[model samples]
Target: MPDLPILLIVVVGIALVFDFTNGAHDSANAIATIVSTKVLSPLTAVLMAGALNLLGAFLGESVAHTIGSGIVQPEMVAGSQGLVLAALLGAIFWNLLTWYLGIPSSSSHALIGGLIGAAVAYGGWDAPLYGSIGAKVIVPLLLSPLAGFLSGYLLMVLLSWLVVRSTPGRVNFLFKKLQIVSSAFMATSHGLNDAQKTMGIITLALFTFHEIPEMAVPFWVKLACALAMGLGTASGGWKIVKTMGHKIFKLEPIHGFAAETAAAAVICTASAMGAPISTTHTISTTVIGVGASKRLSAVRWGVAGRLVVAWVLTIPAAALVSALCYWFLAVTGLAV
Candidate 1:
């Protein structure tokens, strides 16, 4: 091991803070339906989401690896702690802002966008991994929600058709129990996809500091990020929960189960593919699909439009903030 600088330690701490915020903001993705449908109390749902998220964190490193080298080169950015800090600030601020406004935004994109801005600030036109960002982050951000929506819609249609002969009361009773399991699945997938991002950022820092010659994420990094996110999830965010559970669609137990299952499958697949797709996007689209399956009118187009606006703006907004922050650092002669 090398001598760790105070800056490195501080960076680690800040990364954990971002991880915590990601978990808290995204907890709504996992528990919204289960809580909304009366399948689980809020406390019970959050506790389960938190625990499962932690457990899920142990399952994959692909997303971490994607983020580590996918956005900006750690080696290039490592010497400039100010730049890194600026990027983190951009992401953290965005997460808090969206959470406060009860809008579900992508924590994944915020970090990536911040990194893009910081890299552009530090490297000008020579920013590392620019191509990778378009291929990995932007492409996935656009497509995953479409996938989620389609899958959720198709699943809901199939399930609805299968159970069409069942009484409404009976279907509701069955799906209520099913929602508990679906929530757990979604929470676990959420951890697998989201926590890995912090792990990547931390590992990227380690590489930049030359503590590690490569961008390999260590076990401690993974565990720390995982735990941070889980605790955040346990803390929960009910405001966003309302937005996800009720505003996107009027979820009954049946809709909740379908939406969760559809979203979980999409997220887990993306995790396996090393794509850092947004749980917020996936779940929101899945819910929208489930909403449409009942009737187009069941989905709140106005609220959905607002969320789409937030999604469209997240990357650019975080990037602009990060770019400005890095500019401040540069102009002040504090970049390194």
Candidate 2:
């Protein structure tokens, strides 16, 4: 038990590291559209996203609790420092890889997959909370991107038709103003959902070591998670920004507005339900939707296809890495 407290501290640190990576990896979601459309400078977009993301932390905590306790059994997580470390390492490595590749993969899924992989490696069939896991993790993963795609597509078509006769200059002027409002919503949704993943992991670590009561997420922890992600977003991930903003599609102000609005809505909906979906997936798919509205050829299916491959691989890759880390630690006698 004495060792458990020390291990818990280590896991908390790892969780924050994961949170930081999450921000860097997913910052593309918040800034891509605005930057792509030239509605905002990259620097300005990131700063806005970071600030609103921090502000968003104050919005809610339901999602945080679900991630901390709803995924796996606390009793099993107890005395499992090796497992936690493995899971974190797995997710971290994947984030770095995808970030470098300019693929906006699912940070949320990577973390969840890492945990599942680590738990399965260590616990086999005894991994806790599979039923809830399916409902919360897998179901949302499938639906969020699709929801973003449809929403963005529909919104863009409607907006385009409504302003069909308007001058391009006037349309740009109006959406430029509207982008600020929608971007805030997107950033806020980001904080409400993405920040909660870290909060959950931290809370889970605390509960694993018996530092908290009944796996509850505390106010202070929520603030810290939000701050970590916001800070990381402020620091920025320029490589991904370039890819998301320029490579996938040619975007204008209206496209940016539609994509951001759609992404924000999907993310916020998932957050309110305590479900953690990938902000990366949601925004990327939305961007595609906007681009596709122009024509199939306009969307650059090649780049997007590669991104899809990365998204599909994220969970298993992180999970495998975490499992390997767990095995190495266990065999080396670092975790018992």
Candidate 3:
């Protein structure tokens, strides 16, 4: 047998690469509101957001456990290290593809889809825990955006009603100040959930290698994923920032504040629930909800529809890519 540690190392490296791509692709989720509201310059916003994301990564492991052991049984794959690598390759490629096209796709879904695809490829038809996947991932993925939209719409309506007598300038000035706080909360919530995905995958790899008898995320894996995600956030991605900060809806300070707050609440709640959700999906729909609260036509539904199509396609598309990747690895005898 090959030296498993060497393969594990390579897989861990690839996991970090996936985490980096995730941070860059999803950084807009961390900073979009503050940037759009002009409450902070893009640079300042990302830096602040990145720092908070790093801090938040140290929060809990419910999400990590969900991804690490809930998605697929790690021991079933042939050369499990190779499976992770193939899966990361598929997910990373999808993330880069979507980023280049300025689509706010879900990295969480991509990784989950890749895991399922690679598992099925390696273990034939009986590898995945379908019920766990549906409960832990699919349901959360479907509901988070809807929660964001509903919360944002209601929150905006309430805020508008409460501040009805306030001058427009006063409200804008106040929300501009508050937006800094809301944006940071969103970024922290993002790190709480998204960064845990890689930490979970790496831990699952450890279990596959028998480095640990049980599936548990080590502190070192947590630190590495957190730092990688933070660095990627610092580097930033302008493409999706444009899509998120503008295309979904034009935001004034109050709109930005409302969307950020609502999305942050939904994500944090999901994180505590051990469910992995797309920060992008939540934030985009929150913006749409906030816009619609002002006027139904205020949201760019065409763009929103296109985004929804991409969201719906993310799982199947990434799965197909990872399936091909697994096939290539198997045919080459690389995973044997």
Candidate 4:
């Protein structure tokens, strides 16, 4: 095995890289609606989203705690730093692949899947806490999108009824202004839920290296992950943004406001509960819900079908990659 200090550095660096890609890939979740609706220019929207994402990262550590010790058994993989490295590599690979293909897949699931796969590879079937994952991770992953869809559909209906007597021009003008606030809220929630995944991974690595006595995320770890997420958000992701902003549904400013507001609410709640739900899934489904509320035909189900396929495949696919990565690392005598 390489020097402990050097391996720890490499693992932490890869973890940060994963965090950066996460922000870039998922940036569309926060800004796509506002950008598509022309409520904010792309530059202004990403800038605001990036800054708000940073602030959101500082809001809570519950999700971070969940990520660090809830999914995989920390003691089982403590000395095997390569397992953590492989997990991050798997997640980063999936993030880049989905970004290139313009699919709004779940980075949150990818990370969880990677950890599960790498843990299993390192210590067999007993390595991961399946019950904890089912209770905390899978349950929230399934329910958050459902909650977003229902909230968005109901909210859009309410907004439409409230504006029933108003002219279309007046409604559009009013929502255009309101969408900006909704978009900011969406961005903050995105950071709150997403950035903490990296914080947890880093804390896991610190524990693995005995750099920290427990699984708690240090202040420096939180700050570094937040900054990486913020910078990645600033870089923007146009490919996925095009898919999210225009393909699944044609979003008017009112629809954008409804989708962002509903998604943000669901995401923030999940973060508080220490559930690492996908902001991408929440916003995408909310957009679908808002469009369906307008008319069933308003949403392009074909595009949504493709997104669902990608979403369903994210966890298993990332797990396979991480498992392969762990095997290679072990075979190469890097699994210290």
Candidate 5:
């Protein structure tokens, strides 16, 4: 068995690794519309997103606190490095698998699912605080994407009707310039919401092991977690970018601006309420809304259906992986 100190370090390292994966996996949410619309090149788009993500990290810490406390009981989590390790591995593996498949699923759901799965595997179904999780996670997840779709659909319809008399070139030219603002909004919302998840996990680990006080995620903890996520976003997740930017919708500047703006609005509102929503789901649904606004034929329902399947499977897939890892750790008596 590894020494307790070394085991703690390893667990924390795994947590950060999971955080990095979260950033790379979700970076597409921030830049997909901009890239698809040619508002920014791949490299410039990622760089812009990375910078805004870093700036947005300081916006709020409520979501972090929620994740740290809302899912599992603090007592169940404490002194269990193996459990935390299992959770991180589960989330990381699911993220990589989805990215490889070019699926835009929820990294947030993956993380929570991992933790709940491992916790249930070890402690049974009642191990998780299902009430808190239901109120905070499950409900919001269901509503957010639907909200994004409706909002994006309405925005596009309004924009189109308002500019119907304008030439296509004039509308495209105007919206191309406006896409910059929407892109910034998306990036900022992505950072504020997604990075806090990593912060939540890290703080949960620290609190569990008595490295930090209960109920408070330290300032330094927030800064370091935010920085790690920002760096990961800066590196970009190129594979999934193509999937989000081109596969779901062939967007023009107008579609991009409307979809991104709608997604940003939903995400930022959720962030203020400390809900950790899936930015991927929000943005993808928005794009679908935008595409459908032109006509139902303009949207590719077949491809969109596949993505929804991936989202449905993400949580359970991550949980299964985490549960297996936990079983391995328990059998070997490793310090993970």
Candidate 6:
């Protein structure tokens, strides 16, 4: 086995790598609608999203605190740094696979699943703080998407009613401009929720190594994660972008504006509450809801069904992989 300091360095590097993959994988959540609606060119949209994502990362550390200490027990993590490595490997593997397949699964869930699986593998089933996981992670995981869908549907309906007397050309022209603000709001919220997950992971590792007296995130850790996520967002994930922007439903400027507005509101609220909800799930369901407000058949149920399947499987699949990773590390005598 390598020295502890060296291993600690490797774990931090991998955590940042996972953060980068997270940004690339979930960038579509921030910009897909605006791109699909032609409100902004793809290049312009990603650049803007990347900048806002960086800015939003500086907003708060509540989500980071939850991630660092809310799910796993600190005592178990104190010496078992290898388990954290396995968890990150599991998440990165899942994120890449889903990105290649153009599935916008939740990176947030993938990380949480990886942590749960690795913790169980290393320290038994009782290692995790089940109550915290149930309340902070699971409840938010289940409810945020529902909130997004209902909000999107209701908001779209309200918008349609308001514009009923307006000309189609007038509505399109008005919303095209408004969608830009909504898109920026969505991107900022995405950064706030998503970048903090990496911050929490790195801080957890530092706490494990006794480098930090407590689980508080250091400023450097936050800055590094924010930059990694921003660069990854700039690199873009075009395949998932196609799936998110065009596969579930065809979006016009009005629909894009409504969906972004609803999803952003849900995400920002979750961030404030320190719930690491999936921006992907929130945005996807909002798109569907916005479309459904038009009619039942307006949404491509077949595509939406595939997304649901991926969502349901993400936790278990990533968990299984992380468990296997932990098992391998243990067998190799590398998990201390």
- Candidate 1: regions farther than 4 A off: 1-4, 331-334
Compared with the true structure, what per-residue lDDT tens digits does model 1 show for residues 104-201?
99999999888888888887767758788788888889999999999999999999999999999999999999899999999999999999999998
Q: What lDDT score belongs to each candidate, Candidate 1 first?
A: 0.90, 0.85, 0.88, 0.93, 0.86, 0.93
**Better model by lDDT: candidate 1 vs candidate 6:** 6
Better of 1 and 4 by TM-score: 4
Q: Residues 10-101, candidate 5, lDDT per residue (tens digit)?
A: 87788777777778888899888888788889899888888898888878998998788888887776777677778889999999888887
Model 1 TM-score, 2 decimals: 0.97
TM-scores of the candidates are 0.97, 0.96, 0.98, 0.99, 0.97, 0.99
Evaluate model 3: give its TM-score: 0.98
Q: Is candidate 1 or candidate 4 better by lDDT?
A: 4
Model 2, 1-336: lDDT tens per residue? 336667777778888889988887888788877877787887898999998889887788878877777777778777676777788889999998988777788888899888888888888867858888889888988998899889988899999999999999999999988987888788889988999888888887777666776777888888788888998888888889888888888888888899999999999999899898889889988989988887889988999999889988988899889889888888887665
Question: Least accurate stretch of 10 residues (summed lDDT) in model 4?
Answer: 75-84
Q: Which stretches of candidate 6 lie over 4 Å from their true place?
A: none
Each candidate's number of clashing pairs is 0, 0, 0, 0, 0, 0
Residue 95, model 3: lDDT of: 93
Estimate the lDDT of model 4: 0.93
Residue 263 error, candidate 3, Å:
0.4
